[model samples]
Target: MKTRMLKIEGPRKLVLVEKELVLEDDEVLVRTLQSSICGTDKMYYRGEMPPNEKYPLFIGHEGGGVVEAVGSKVDEYQAGDLVMSFSRSCTFADYFKTKPINLQPVPEGLDMRIAALGEPLACAMHSVLESGVQLGDTVAVMGMGFAGQIMLQGARKKGATKIIAIDVLEDKLKLAKKMGADVTINPAKENLYQTIMGLTNGQGVDVVFEAAGNQDSLNACSAILKHNGHLVLYSWLTQPVTLNMHRWHQNSFKIITTTLVHHTKYERIVWSEKAMRPFQQGLIDVEPLISAEYKLADIKEAFEESVNNDEIIKIIIKP
Candidate 1:
């Protein structure tokens, strides 16, 4: 069948192009409903991600849709089931094929639009767990983008006290506050180290999350971590960045790197179901963070707007 798909035909250029999809024997063809933009998508759009994705590659990984057709081997879902999927579903298209292992049936009464965001929330959940945040622990999260904001929420749910949110954008800081961040900081306008020290009684935070994906943010993550504290690196820095290992070594800091793609499909699904349950129940609301939505054909414009507008957080593309 013919469908519209986002094609990365060249560096920094994404265009909606018609494509034909053929389902293999083990795959299920899904009619794309809603696909969300991620921070990694932004980095790929700007040609920063390494290993150089081949030209004309489809560009979406997080989304939900209906089962259009099931392969002969697929028995878990019928043709009309509603499902959410992650990691290489290529959901930019109106209809795409994925393995049954990748698609999870959305629980009853859950909004597919928000459920499309399960992947990011799950990754944030993993990072938060890896950070080893304890109740009453002081935690500082750098960056308030989609993933970072969710990470802050995860920290709050982990019983973190004195949760510090840092970003250069004032609007994001406001969103961070809405997401239950105890304190927000704009490093451009304030000193992150001083504010974090002051908030934690000069010992720095018990844990720090580096979600901003930059050298400066990594440095701040190291500086803000207390002795024997945990530093969770959740960002994917596309370029090679330097770090001062002396501080980490001397302070006995523990650095942890976690990625959603590295996780097994079963692991991802279990954690996603648990982490996204709060959002599904309206307890953890991310409505304030979804700044824009666009149809599949207008995704290029959506990406451009997201890059140009500092106030924009998460942008969703509906097919």
Candidate 2:
């Protein structure tokens, strides 16, 4: 069968091209129901590709859909099973095929829309788990995007008494407050240092999550953490950034890197299921984080809007 897939022909160029798919013996065919753009996708869209990677390639990794078909050797999945994607098989398309290992079964009774965001949601949740947030501890999330929004709620679940969400966009900070943030700081407008110090009573947060993949956000995260506090690094900053490293050693910060899929495939599958349980059971909210939706054919416009709009938390692509 043929699928309308996205191809990054070059920098700032996205075109939907036809791809003929043939299922392998250990593979499963998925009819994509929902998918969304990731921060990493934005990097490739803008041409900040890795040194070894090139353009004119398939470029999407977060989505979920129903199983349309499965290969003869595939026993873990069958036709009509709802599954969330966990690998890059050009999910920005009508349909795609992958090994069963890359497809995760949707939890019972969870919204398919949330399930469609399997990869990112799972990653954020895992990061929160790795985040050493004790009961009554003060925590801050550096960005209010999709992952950061979810992390804010997850931090609360993990027993962060004061959840401070920082962002430049008012809408995201507003949504962050509505979700679970006790305090929202727009560093663009207000004095972040003074306000954060006042709120923390001059001590600073016990943990800070660097959700925004930029130099400024990283700097701000470092500036606000208490001595020996956990600095949960979540962003995949594609570009090199210069940071003031004096505080890192002087303050004795414990840097934590939480990349969920870096685990073995079996570990990833097991951990992904564990990470999604809270979302499935309504402990965390994802429905509101999805700010917009666009059809597959209108991806160019979608990418354009996503790039230009700072308030859009997450944009779903419907195929």
Candidate 3:
């Protein structure tokens, strides 16, 4: 069957192209239900990270769909199964086919809208689950974007006594307050280090999630980390940021990196279910995270909005 798929000819150039898809014996065909834009997608789209032959060449992954058809060898999933792409397969299209191992069934109670953000949500939640955020521990999330917002909520649910949300954007900081952050810090306005130090009584926070992914946020995280703290790297450094190694060595910080999509398919499936459980149970709501929705045909406009609007959290495209 032929379907409309997004193809990035080069940086800042996205065009819908017709592609023929054939199901292999071990693969499943999925009818796209919801697709969203990702930071990596914006990077590729803006020419920050040029698409190479090996990775993110076509810039489409954040999405979930229902199983339209399953191949002969696939028995674990059948037609009409609610699934999300686990492994990389260009997903910004009406339909696409991939290996059964690459498809993960949405959690039992999670809404399709939340589960549709499969990879990103799983990644952020996984970071929180493994972040060593214990009861009464003071935590700081260094970004209020999509993943940061979710991480803030997860940290709060994990019993963090004082949750600090950090971002330059006031709009995100405002949302952070509604999302359960006890304190919101806009580094652009206040001195991040001094403010966090005051909040923690000069001891620093127990864990700091580096969700902003930049040199400044990284530096700020290092400065306010406790003597022995957890630095969960949720991935991203926008444009190849430099790391200040002084505090990193003296503070003896525990650097943790969590990106669920980078692991084995089985791990992605298992971790995703666990990571998304909170959302399924309504302990966390992703409705606010979805800032806007656009039709698949208005694909370029969606990408353009990502560039023009920093307040836009997650943009979903329905085909």
Candidate 4:
């Protein structure tokens, strides 16, 4: 069968074209309902991604859909089952196939639209879980983008008493406040180091998440981390960026790199469900992050608008 999918022809150029869909013995075919534009997708679109791909590569990695067909080798899901898939490839299409291990069954009452976000949410949950964020800790998220916002929410759920959200945009800062950030700072307007120090009584935050993929954030991450604090680098820096190791060495901070793709297949399946449970209960809402939506045919326009609009948190495409 033929499926319509989004392809990245080159930097800043996206095309929606029909492609052949081949079924694999161990794969289950999914009719994509909703797929959202992720930070990695934006990086690949703008030529900022370090990991290169062949031309016309399938672009999306976050989405949820219904099972259209079940392979003979698959038994975890059947046709017509509502499901979400992550850390897999070729998600931006009317139909895509995945191994049973990568698919997570969506709870009966969950919203499928937000279930599409399971990948990003799972990454945030992993970071929070690994960071060892505990009750009464002071946490600071260095960005207000999708993953950063979700991590801030996760930090709150982990029992943080003081949560500081940092971003360059005023609108995102407003959204951070709504998402339970006790403090929000625009690095452009206020000194990020000063704000973190002030919020933590000059001791710095117990946990600092570096979501901005730049050297400035890298340097500031160490500065804001308290002695023996945990620092999670959540953003993928495609380019070579310098880091100040002096503070890291002096403070003995535990710096860990967080990535959803690096998790084992079994770990992803476990966390994907744990991550989506709150959203399933309507406790952690994702409605504020969805800034725009488009049909598969208009994905090029959607990508262009999302790039120009820095205020956009997430954009979903319907197939």
TM-scores for candidates 1 onward, in order: 0.94, 0.96, 0.95, 0.95
TM-score for predicted model 1 compared with the true structure: 0.94
Query: What lDDT does the true structure give each of the candidates?
Result: 0.83, 0.91, 0.86, 0.83
Give each prediction's root-mean-square deviation over alpha carbons: 1.6, 1.3, 1.7, 1.6
Candidates sorted on TM-score, descending: 2, 3, 4, 1
lDDT of 3 by residue, 1-319 (tens): 7899998877778889888999889989999999899887887787776333433256678789999998899998999899977666788899988887777888887788888898888889999999999999999999899999999989988999999999998888888999889999888888988998898889999999989877888888888999999988886654666778787788888988888877777777788889878878888878988999999899999999988887898999999
Quality of model 4 by C-alpha lDDT: 0.83
lDDT, candidate 2, 1-319, per-residue tens: 8999999988888889998999988999999999999988988988888677887889889999999999999999989999999988789999999999988999999989889998999999999998988999999999899889989999998889999999999988889989989999999999998899999889889999999989999999889999898999999877788998788899999999987877788999989989999988889878888889999999999998888887788899998
Model 4 Cα lDDT, one tens digit per residue, 152-238: 988888899999999888988999999899989988998888877877788999998888778998888888899999989888888
Which one wins on TM-score? 2
Better of 2 and 4 by lDDT: 2
Candidate 4 positional error at 122, Å: 1.6
- What is the per-residue lDDT of model 1 for residues 12-130, given as tens digits with 9 covering 90 to 100? 78888887888888999999888888888887787775676656567888888999998898898889998887777888889888898887788678887777776776677678766
Candidate 4: give the clashing pairs: none
Judged by whole-model lDDT over C-alpha atoms, candidate 2 comes out at 0.91
lDDT of 4 at 266: 86
- Number of clashing residue pairs in every model? 0, 0, 0, 0
